[model samples]
Target: MPAEPLEKGQTRFALRAPSARRVAVVIEGEAHPMNRDPDGLYSAEFGAPAGTLYRFRVTTGGGEELEVPDPASRFQPEDVHGPSEVVDTRAFGRPDAGWRGRPWHETVLYELHVGAFTPEGTYEAAAGKLDHLRDLGVTAVELMPLSDFPGGRNWGYDGVLPYAPDSSYGRPESLRAFAAAAHERGIQVFLDVVYNHFGPDGNYLSAYAPEFFTDRHETPWGAAINMDGRGSGYVREFFIRNALYWLSDYGLDGLRLDAVHAILDDSPEHFLTELARRVQEGPGAGRHVHLLLENEENEASRLLGGGSSDSVYTAQWNDDIHHALHVSATGEGASYYSDFADAPVARLGRCLAEGFAFQGDPSQHRGNARGEPSGHLSPLRFVSLLQNHDQVGNRAFGDRISESVSSEVVRAVAAVYLLAPQVPMLFMGEEWAASSPFQFFCDFDGDLARLVTEGRRREFQKFPEFSEEATRERIPDPSDEQTFLDSKLVWDERGDLENAEILDFYTDALAVRRAEIVPRLEGIPGTGAQQRLVGERGLRVQWPLADGSLLSLLANLSEKESGGFEPPPGRLIFATNDTGPDDTGNLSAWTVAWYLLENNS
Candidate 1:
């Protein structure tokens, strides 16, 4: 194969596929022949190129001309999803790229949707808010997927262009600028990416590149991507290069892979295993690269590769705990609420102390046994959170769990999540209890909008509380400035009474975790040992603190019961839930009491 070049007058391009004999690059007014380079890279340069009206002319194994985007183009047209405008990824002023790489457990993650993170809702607006996260003790911010979606606004799961930051979010410059600014604040940035399925609309890859997917395999959305098919070699290369591009070209600190369980492959060791290896050898790994997954299978294999990852993806989102806690927090008896209700705090504590609950337990929802005992993995390997974006937006009205629980319970739960052995993550506005709802929002063409509105209502019709009419009505119009406005964090309310109190509680809780617990967790001891003294209304957990003491921190989960707690008679550091008339946001429900026991012996 030979590298492709612009035929006389052309402003567009296509990727080199060794299997394809002929290829053409089509810009606005002209089409050019492409030559493949020795490295299998397709090349076509234009005299003048600027906007998004670009598509490829690809000739596959069989003689045919179909249009597709430059496999890794930076920006694509809104509706066409064909070849996109070529961008100099380094065009947006590149940062010094030097960053202090922090380990997975060492990071405090703050998750935000770029579209709704600020009133401007672009990458630039988010850059302005880095100060708030820095002050809140956040060392990293994990962004929702930024790949190019169909319309001007989306949740970003239906991305078609993997190489580019969504043009709707801003230009390539804006994204690179934001990355540079974030690094300057001593904050690492992680990007979430989707590869399971190409979206329904604006997916034109099938037109030009037939080998990218396989009808032999099935996915919930459509045909599974051709990972293990005849041309699987290039297929793996396509995704692996994208992973490294974000880390090397974009200077990303980490990647949160969306729906890895859906990415099925029969290759030896697995694509995930290979992908993790390549990323660790990439640029971020020179600094360091953290890999995370949103998995439904609870498969331990992704983290078990023993690859060069900092801690083999230090943690996964603990959804079973989230489900259990959500059911306990909100009395809402809705879908998938079966396994949780009435599940004791002991069960929750066991999951926190160790990862993976439902280990061989008969799950009524799954109709089978679930999970192996995660006894051997470090506690820092599972990230636990009270509320994330999915828990909110996926709801009919997108009600936050805070709406149901008392402030005390919220504060207490926050303590368990932030102070626990695993990494802690926070959804936007959760720290201050913002009233604005983060509803399911999207913008599609008019007829497609009607289809989406109608389709969404019919899907959730079974839930008694989920009204079809209201569900349809609740889908926020993505283009509406008001919808975006409703989601921004209200920074002004930080000094108000209620929000201020929530802020103080969060700050104090964070202080305790860093000061009292982190060191002990860094060098954990024992393998597969359960330590707990259960009482009628309280529980005491005894685990060796890597710092010094054989620590036993007891908690009273029930207000109706009390017990005697004898320490080594050191200083009482802090009491979390002791709610007084003039207490500083410390309440009876969901509270913590801290102590620094001294060895007087």
Candidate 2:
């Protein structure tokens, strides 16, 4: 029989397990013992009203207790697995305003974290920063996940609730407000959704539906989500429903799925394909509903996912690019950095032109062959970024690309990333080069909190600047007001001459894109791409620009050597480092230059 429709403040729930005893509904401020009927539903009445806080406290015979937040709670306040909050999601919502814009290919993607995007660290506060995003020339805002996780502040990846938004960001209504506001500004809102696994805490899908998990596989967190195991069908339904809720109810333009590599599902029908079919045939039929992934393996098959998607997504974040640039620019050679330093600049150029620097190459870091060539897929199906949250936050010292490398190198790489065929993503405060460390910190339950600290430290003990003790010592307290404050963007710093220059450089590049390139060379078939070594520590890249012109990219890898590039006699459009050889033809240190060929057709 179909379940009864819920009215405001009313939720009907049931569990079939006969072995279970002592079931209670956790309502706002108190726990109410449920009345179990032969029909199997254990329910209770609550005067707690709409937007009440709750979670289920279920106990078994052995005195073992499990606290699972409401399976369908509208919000998670304590964290992803923490106490659940009742919210009339529909009450705080409007009609799905719908995406009214161009395709995702033309988008200027901007990635931001709600906690650090503004001082208030809430959805409402993030809404205020939208104007700044607009001024920065970004057309789409790719938010970090808002799914429930423990504590008010987190990176948002450890979310347990498949549907609820973190209450720390504001009520469910505020997310709708953000999406609406972004649409009003001609900007698309792309939400980051994680379905790989739920948080270690407050997870209760197994009790409600035994088929939502599998014993076949496990992830770093714990048991993986039940997508292919028993109850796989319902698990898929739960996720699809959650995604549809965000899109249809909140009016998100797109959803950037997180860590798809960890989504270990072996179902025959395949959940990804089915979800894609449902979405495309639904309200977002005409406009783009991007499904991005952060797959480390670079499996082209997942992107192709049987074409259920419009090609696996508009793009996937290229961690290879980030890693390569980090090693080259920062001169860091601890762990994964080892594989990148030995990588050739020619490989990076091929990635810029063809997308995949390590396609089929033996990856020292992963100890296996990695990635398919970008030539195997559409150029638009990749997102190139020099810096992102995890790349910075997961660091021993949590240093951003801006802090470790010279602004010159940062600007140089930015040019390549923006001009490349793939979509480009910018972390918050990257534009003004704000000095803030987005470290990995969490506030868990008392017993589990200690485990998290020890676990985190143990994972990084092998790395050079990372000791278990040092790692624990630096773990920022999530409850501390200053941790969030430390991540806020200093908008006024743009007034400083150095930052002003970087800001101007970015503006000019983007203006050139909007006014000139978009009109003249939109998605120009990148060609004549060839690169060569200039001795042991330097290399040069040549790109065939318009009208028989050439753009030369130069980088000096060694501390002692300076690199040079000889243009085919034309004006210098931009330079990423020391002024490339002056008119007298003397190259500067680690210079990266873009010069047009004298159009002598």
Candidate 3:
């Protein structure tokens, strides 16, 4: 919720610091001490006008004084280390006031990082491009994290102040305007948020409330957040409120929680359950407020309605489908790719027909069983994608698959996910096969910059390709401005012939999905989709409709063309390679075709 500027130009301030002996609201070098309650909350009303900058002067254990930004700051116009500005989020008018968000099953998400989305990289500039996405059949724009970070350029996962929108993206209202512009074009907007751990730089929670973090468990970042430890109820409320704030204040349609697997909690009722419950019971009760999760563990229970009635998330990112497609496109079996290479096409077939490929099955790559049975769940419960931030940015060179695979492979993969029953997502520039790379870029300074650059290079030492001296030197510096500049998308190339061809493929596939597939699949309910391997690497899928008709897909995964496979006697709708029956009817190598099998009975 936004702070209310009371009458007489005084603003009420509050801080939840259980361990603080004294707290003061400092405005322009003037300090006004606050009153502490028995419940450990310190608050005071001061004669500070709206937009007045303020910071907390807290006395912690042992009487150490520290100045820090408010944990629930509505706006941080300066750097994260600077004071917070009082923002009346309600003052901004909702541009698309009549827009009620769409349902989960209707979403066709296009993910992009605002900084590298365009040259200007501001919300206004990004909003100007919504027409392109809207024309391409994108229903929503899943922005990469926009929370306040240390510097101007970042991937946004390193955000510290979760409540404040990054000043580099313009004011908070700019983001609201961006969302409204998207809504005007009939597109929904959502944000990716990081709650597992705060970034290393600009973090100040420990100074006043060290209990916000705990050593009970370890995550890849370090000690996990105090989600279920002593005094953790307050910490949980902080994040739960953050979730509601984004939806209610910015008019955002939803939120994508990053890496829920890393959020360690052992309570009887998980924090995620609590978050869902509170959101549905609070301001989001009557809205189409969707919650998406990025759970790397492939956990399906939470998504399969194991949580409370109102606590289940709409869906989760299906990395299994992406891994299978990546392995099939390029036979790179390093790291996490190893588990997906054995029978890549078969694995993809499973994901296309079912929700997960590894459901409580042993993972040869992880040396243990992974995932849970999700076949009983709806196919829309998964968000399938070809290229995303992690898949591209995690590479040693931060190269997209477009840089790695042939144009034919890109078209085939695009057709697979776009036409599948699951909700489809396209990374920015993926539609036109943009040439620019989306690298791991940042703007950290001094020792932290050096450490980040060195650590990024060192982290890849496990791979033989990155360990070599020559390859190591080729790695882009994460802290370099040039690296950040290199990641910007080139909007002019959308019309180039080669790029246009791929873009046409995406557009045509999406058009077909909207006009033909979605209505039939969503209107009627069954097992969603049924699939059978046509050959060693070919798959034939049948999606039954309400009228007993079937929408079929035939795909060839091998490089060599094979013959003698026929559709169930219906209209031939679309084809990638334009290959038909080889006198006996076969699909060409790396080709995908869709057919509408009408009910003849």
Model 2 clash tally, residue pairs: 7
Tens-digit per-residue lDDT, 314-389, candidate 2: 5678777777666767767667666777654545655665566777788887788887655555446668887788
- Compared with the true structure, all predictions reach lDDT values of 0.67, 0.67, 0.86
Error of 1 at 421 (Å): 1.4
Put down candidate 3 lDDT per residue, 404-443, tens digits, no spaces: 8899988888888997778899999999999999889998
For model 1, residues 541-576, the per-residue Cα lDDT tens digits are 555445554444445555443444444233444456
Model 2's lDDT to the true fold? 0.67
Of the two candidates 1 and 3, the one with more favorable lDDT, higher being better, is 3
For candidate 2, the per-residue lDDT at 568 reads: 40
TM-score of 3: 0.96
Q: Over 4 Å off in model 3, which ranges?
A: 1-3, 304-311, 523-528, 546-548, 579-583, 598-601
**TM-score, each model?**
0.87, 0.84, 0.96
Q: Give per-residue lDDT, candidate 1, residue 183.
A: 84
**Candidate 2, which ten residues in sequence have the lowest lDDT sum?**
516-525
In candidate 1, which residue ranges exceed 4 Å CA deviation? 1-22, 36-53, 59-67, 77-83, 91-94, 304-311, 467-485, 525-538, 550-552, 559-574, 578-588, 595-601
